[model samples]
Every structure is written in C-alpha cells, then in structure tokens.
Target: MLQPLPQEQTIMAETDRISQLPADIVDNILGFLPIEDAAKTVVLSTNWGGIWPNLTQLCFAPHFFRRLKNRYSTKHAAFYVITKILLQHQGPTIRKFEVDYYDSKTETVKSRSYDIDQWLLLVTRKGVEEIKLHLGSQEYRLPDCVLSCRTLKSLDLDSLLVRPLRSTYMLPNVASLRFRSINLDFFSDLVLDVPSLENLSCEECYEMFHLHIIAKSICSLNIRYCSGRELDSFIPVNMDLRSIRTLHLDSHSLQNFVDDCSRTGLPLRSPALNVEDLNLSDFCFKEETQASPLIRLLHICPNLIKLHISLWCPVTWRCDSTYDDEKDIPSVAEVDRRLPELRSVAQRHKRLVTLKLILFKGFWCEMLFIKELLAALPSLQEVIIGHSNDMDSKRKCEVMERVLHFPRASTEANVTCI
Candidate 1:
C-alpha cells in the first residue's frame, strides 16, 4: 500500500543496493577478476576504489594489463602499473599472489629484479598463503623474504635459483610445492621440512648430488628428467613419504633411480610401492633396450589400479657413402619387436582395472603389445587409446576396429579410442 517511487529515485535505489553489498563479499567478487579488471570497477562508483583494495587474491600475469598499440611499450607500462598497485594496495590479508612476468628481448630481467623483489616483499608482509613466481630468465633469484615466509601454504617456482639460506630453513605450513627448470646443484640436501606438504612435482632441475624429500605427509609425486646423459652422475635421491597414492616417473628418471640404488646397494623399496595410480612417459624402446628396470618397478607397485604409458620413438639416420646421396635414408623402427613379452611382466597385477596407452604411432609392434595386454589381464575393465590429433581418421578407425576384435579375458571390458 505504498506509492511507486519516481523513476530516477528507483534507479538510485537499485544502484545503492549494489554499493551496499558487504565489504568481504565485494572483495571476493573482485578477487575472481583480473587485477586490471577489478581496478576498472573504480569507475563504477567512488566507493569501488576502497573495495578493490580489499581483494585477497592478486594475480599479475601478462594479460592483467591493457594491451598497448605498441607491443614493445607494454612491458614497461605493465611494470609501472604493477609497481604502483603494490605500493597502493592496503589489503591486510592475501590468500594468493601469482606473478608471471614474461618480457620481450628489449627488456632485460636484470633491470626488473629489484622491482620484483620489492613487490614480493610487499605481498610477503600481507601473509600470503600461496605464491607462484615464474620469471623469464634463470639469473633472477627469488628474494629471501619469500623463501623464509612462514605463512606460505603453497609454492610453485620456475626458472629461479632456490638455494637454501641456512642449515635449518623451514616452510612450516606449505602443503604443496612444484619446481620447474630450477637449479638445485648447490644444495647438498634439498630438505623439505614442511610436514604438511602432500604434493611434490620436480621437473627439469639441475643435476643434484642429493635430493632429500622429507615430507612425511606427501601422497603424490612426479619427477621427469631434464637431461638424459646426466643420469649416470646423479646422486642417490631419497624420499621419506608416508603413503603415496599417485606416482609418475619418466623413463630416464626411473632408470637412473633404479641404477643408482642397484650400484649403491640401497634397498629399492619405499612408499612408492603403495601407489595406486602410475603414469610412465617418455619411454623409449629398442632391440637392445633392457626391460628389467621397468619390470622391477611394476613388480614393486602391486596395488596399481591405473596404468598409463607413453612410448618415445627416436629417428636415426644412417648415411651410406656408396650412394653419395643425403636423401636416400632408411626408415628406422624403434618400438621393440619383443615388446609382446611385457604381458608376462604385467600378469602379476590381479587388481589392474584401467590401462591407458598414449601417443601410439600405429606400429604393428605396439598393436601386438596391446593385444597381449588385453589377453593377459583378466580384471581389466577399460582400455583408453590416445593418438595424435593429426592422424588420419580412416586409419584410426581401422586401428580401433582391430583392437575391438582383440581377445579380451573380461567380456565386460570396453575399449575407448581417442
């Protein structure tokens, strides 16, 4: 029984409704948007400037800034605006801070290291929970303030120097860590004192004399080789995990670890045996390739429920002096013809349910291996075959049809080709 308000007054009321949203709610809404877009909300109303500062997540990736007409000028402008935002931000609590500052050839990393350190220092003071820092070059090292940040719960470092400052440096609360393209040759023991850490991923790291992953709560691990030739000189890496659920090991890394343990007379058993999901990638096979290393690894992982394998086939060119022609090169087939023998290796796994075959190159040897696997595993529930996108559809269909006809021990087993 109230009279309708005037049109302008109704509009004003609607606008006020949005402006009156709780500060935390407004901050959360802004947190989902890129910092640049969040800052643009300042133009919506006078109150938005204060609301933008309350945002808890700050991400400064390449697309967070406006694209300038001159591509070369964007880096400098981005750096300037980023510095200004850090200086102006008054947020007392930050949950996440991610910075992926990739610059073109014109701007050198040496010039931006100080600004990056300053920005990191500002975020560290705000009690940042998760931090991901990816720089353009290896020369830029992360500031000590970041490494020593006790409040951090997650960290992903790429292309940075991560040498420890002292004997007992600690990340008390960190639960997840990832290192990509990092140099760890200087540290004798890369001790992970984070008892809360559950996930660890290390890839493309410099050859370390010793890597001591001492996280007691770790449940998932992934390690891939950076360089294949350096495996011979690698030190025996030790892991003290409680009960890992998932483990992924590339061909070179698995081979190196196994060889190191064999040479040092150290027990090859660990928490990795409890792994239920296993992924093996970058695995190459030749006539001379030894299958004992991979077979032994599978033997230890008796509880594996899922298995993934990606085969690597290398191209070898043999020049003939008699032909005197560079174009007349013979094609080399690398997938081992004896790969069918792997069925014996996998027969012990009575619990295996899912098998994923990735990057299959339509080789007859590979098809034989698949046939053997289908016939050997009685409990197999499903088989996923992943192939290259560029493969001919007709050829792929033919391959799938052939695999569908393979003798399966389980009648309920289904084959999926992707």
Candidate 2:
C-alpha cells in the first residue's frame, strides 16, 4: 500500500539511528539512567558523546564536594574548580540553584571571601530564579551586584551580616527574607517594593530598625528584637492592618507596650496586633516587685485566635516554704471583674479560635486568674495548659477542670495537660 519509502526519508532515519538502536528507542532508553551514566552510553557507539551538562536544574552539593575534597589537597582550590565547571556550562539556563556551603575545620571568614563574590556573580548572571545562601561561622557580606538581579524572588540569610550601605539598597523583587544575626545600624531603609511579599522574619537584631511597610501584598510577619519603642515614641496600633493575616512577636525589650500605648494614647503606636495566629511572650518582668506589674498583658491582643503566655517573677515574688493556710484565696469572680473591657474587646474580633496558656511560675494567687480566663474566651475551641509539675495531683486535677469545661460548643475538643 505504501509504494516504497522515499530515499531521503530512508537516509534520514538511518542517520538518526545511534549505534544499532533506532533514534526513538535510544532516546527513550537513555532517559531512565542517571545523567552521568547516560552520557557514558555514548561510549557504546559513536552516536552519543555529550549530554549531561544540559540539565535545567543543575545540582552541586554533596557528591560534587566529596569528589573535589578527595582529589585536591586544598578545599579553597576545590571550591574554585567546582565554580569553574558550573560557569563553563552554557545554553541550557538554570531555573533554580542551591549552594549548601559547609566549611572545613580550619577555614575562616577571610579564606572564603574572594571566591564567594565570583560564585554569586556567576549565578546572578545566569538568571537564577530562587537562591538559598546558608553559611556557618565564616560570615560573608552580600555581593555588590545583588541589586541588579532581575529574576531573584526569595532570599534567606541565616547567621550572616548584611554589610551597611551608605545609599538606599533596593532588593526590588525579593518577596520573603529570614535572617538570624544581622547588624542593621548603617543599612539602608526604603519601601520594600516586593509586590508579592508574603512572609518576613528577622531574629536577634539589636539596632532600632525603621521601615515603612510598602508591600501591599504582605500576609505574614515575624519580628524578634528589642528596638523601636521609647517611652516617648508614638507607635500606632497597626495603621496599615488590612492585609496582614498573621503575626508573631517575641520582643522582650519593653516591659508592657499596650499599657504604654494606653498611657501615651498614641494611635500611631498601639500595642494591638490584629492577626489570626498571634503569639506574645512577656519575659521582661522582675520577680521582686511588690505590686502586680504583669497583669495588663491579658488585654494586649484582644482578638488573637491563639495565645501563649509565660510569666516569670524575680526572687522577691517567690513565697517561703512554710505553710500559710490561714491566708484567703482570691475569688474567681473578683479577678474576672478587673478584665471587663478585655472580654468585650475580644468579642469584636472574629479570628479567636484557639488559646494556649504557658505559665512559667505560678502559685495560689494566679490560679484564680487562670480560672476566670477559661470562662472569658467565648469561642475558644481548644486549650493547652502547661505548668511545671511543681504541684501534686490534687491541685493539678482542680486546675485541669477549669480549662476543660469552659469551651461551650467544643464537646469533642482536646485539652492537653502538661
């Protein structure tokens, strides 16, 4: 039926054949093997010789480093060789690249500085979409050309110092940033123009950071530091609050911010953070004060869906070992009346779904406060009550009952006793 295959078609099919296998069969068969081994398949015949370097997402982590370390006596020279190999490959672009840098025992910051800039520049020139730079003690500054990176999206700096710049350094498209230790005293401050930014985290930076929130698409934020609040400074109550869905605050810098907000009456600076998963820890109190200075924390985030509290008093608040049974125990109703405005405030926020109570040290006086709290959260679904096992069984059971019975609608909700 086919009158005989054309001569050009026959010649094309024969040349497409590699060794003895047909073109389709060899290509399909080669896809199953590792790239290195697949390249070795070329030795079986004269048809295939080079194929491994064209992969889109090139990986150079564990295996590459091991081979380099065994071949070369110096680790620095090994890093250079690896850097050259990655730079040589062309045509097929890298979509994502991850450099898991682990320095040897004797390596120091000065040893790795020069080549790091070269490697960063190479990846930048290749148009890397997402980059992760994780380093240990050998801390290095960011490269000069990082601002020019056009396609970079998310960046995470763990235990790295961002070199202070005189001019406003703009990461025009970076969406998410997470860092552990950074010196931000001379760093540039600008409107972070990431239109798609969703998450941001900074931990253990002591300097006061001044940043205007310009990202209209932000959703989650986590900041842990001890700056930005002076007794005289007016910090507003989340002025730009509509876009945020969650926030976690762990700043021990101030004794009490909401009370400070109340005393100053600063709308621009209110301690109230509107979030779906709000967590606050007040670890800035001295145990020896005569009066209760930490009581006002209950009203801080009135609408938080989840709350975790841990309070510690200095040695002065610690009671003597001797018994004082004659002293009266405070009534739950009396403590409840002090928080009249807080419960009403919580009722307005629709996101309070869960509550967690973390009490570092507590005794008789604070228990009544805890019982009243169980009765306060109207829509609470579950509760986690944690206390050091400083008490015996009888007191623990009584404490457990207060938390378990309060959530009216949660018939099957869990109450963890820790």
lDDT of 1 by residue, 1-418 (tens): 9766799788888878877777788877877777777778756876666766667888876565436315556456667777887787777888888877665452455677788889889888999999988775777877789878999999999887766766555888988988888776655654657778888888887764345555766788887865432554453244543267787878877776557655656455432357788888866443233345676676567788898888655433121111123224331233333444466657767788999988865555456567777887778998999975544787777777877898987776789988
Q: What is the TM-score of each candidate against the true structure?
A: 0.82, 0.63
Off by over 4 Å in 2: 1-85, 88-92, 99-107, 137-139, 164-166, 188-192, 210-213, 226-239, 251-274, 282-303, 308-350, 358-369, 386-413
Which residue pairs in candidate 2 collide? 235-268, 235-269, 236-268, 236-269, 236-270, 237-270, 287-313, 287-314
List model 2 lDDT by residue over 194-290, tens digit each: 5566776656653534443446656676666645434232222223443556665553523334344466543422234444676555442222121
Model 1: residue 220 alpha-carbon error in angstroms: 1.1
Span of ten consecutive residues with least summed lDDT in model 1? 317-326
Error of 1 at 17 (Å): 8.5
Predicted structure 1: lDDT: 0.70
Q: Each model's number of backbone clashes? A: 0, 8
At residue 259, what lDDT does model 2 achieve? Answer: 42
Candidate 1, residue 124: the lDDT equals 87
Each model's C-alpha lDDT?
0.70, 0.53
